[model samples]
Target: MSAETASTRLAEIHSRIARAAQIADRRPDDVTLIAVSKTHDAESIQPLIDAGQRVFGENRVQEAAAKWPALKAATPDIRLHLVGQLQSNKAADAVALFDAIHSVDRLSLVAALAKAMAESGKRPDCFIQVNIGDEPQKGGVAVRELPALLAEARAAGLPIVGLMAVPPVGVDPAPYFALLAKLGREVGLTELSIGMSDDFEVAVTIGATHVRVGTALFGARA
Candidate 1:
């Protein structure tokens, strides 16, 4: 996409977000828009960056490490987030590369992240991913196990900031979204990493502090 195309896409999504936030009686600025650049390379992502997008999400630690260093060096404030399942093996690399991590789902990952943080002295914000719909294929911890994971994460100094979830597809996501919000509140977490290109507006209305938007911003993947 051209710079203009990227800027236009950003504006359209922001407008939708602002409208949704207004309906929720919340400020649009409160909801951080993370342009998910999972498969897109620097050349493809540069237009969005040139259009003033500072925050992006990537799926893999290695891909982000390869793509973001130069981009971040040029724009010191660009924040990268890990929005995909995190492997314990990549904990150290993820800690060093991402400004925030949204896939912290298990005790092992929490321990890995804590050890990485201690070794590198870098504490990236973390959101516990909840398998809110009880989907066995998803990357989050089951809802019944959230408390244990939260306790362990907090105990390990993992900067447990909020909850992240991807509701089951092809369903009325409002209930799932509301449930995620309630779960976050129950755990005393104020932030929420819910929503994506399709259901993000519904998510914003339900109090999503962060929305990971890819197709809406970068167009469909090949």
Candidate 2:
């Protein structure tokens, strides 16, 4: 897309966010929209960066490793967020590539990340992922287990910055987002990464510090 087209679309997305914030009696600046660039090429993201989007999210570590190098070569200061499940083996690569990881869900992953951080000499900011829906198959820690998880990550000198969650597929997400915000406060955290393409407005209204939006920004992923 042309820079003009990208700028127009981004403006529209910002307008929607502004409107939603207004409806919730919020300042638009209170919410940071993280354009999810998981399946998108670096070509697709340049225009977005030119249009003044400074933050972007990626789902898979390897794809990010491939894309981010080129993207960063062009836009050196762009902030990269990892919003996907990360495996132990991939921890070093992820620590090297991402500025933040919003999917720290298990004790083992935490230990692996600590070891990787030591090896890489890079400490990526992290969020504790909460399985709020309590689905047996999901990839987050049980909500009740978060404090212990945060404690362990902190002891490793990781910047445990916030909490993240993916609400169950067809349900209302507001309550869950609110729960995260509450948990963040209880834990003295400053970030809450929640919501996505579908319910980001609700998240902003309920005090989400970051919202990961993909399809709404880039069209549906293949």
Predicted model with the maximum TM-score? 1
lDDT of each: 0.95, 0.88
Listed per candidate, the RMSD to the true structure in angstroms reads 0.6, 1.4
Query: Candidate 2 — which pairs collide?
Result: none
Writing each residue's lDDT as its tens digit, candidate 2 over 1-222 gives 679877887888788888888988988898888999988998888888999888999999999988888788788888899999999888888999999999999988998899989988888889999998899988999988888888988997787988998998988998888888888899999788988889988888888888898887787777
Judge candidate 1 against the unseen true structure and give its global Cα lDDT, from 0 to 1. 0.95
Error of 2 at 65 (Å): 1.1
Q: Poorest 10 consecutive residues of model 2 by lDDT?
A: 1-10
Off by over 4 Å in 2: none
lDDT (Cα, tens digit) per residue for candidate 1, span 124-166:
9999999999988899999989999999999999898999999
Error of 2 at 98 (Å): 0.4
Pick out the ten consecutive residues of candidate 1 with the lowest summed lDDT: 130-139
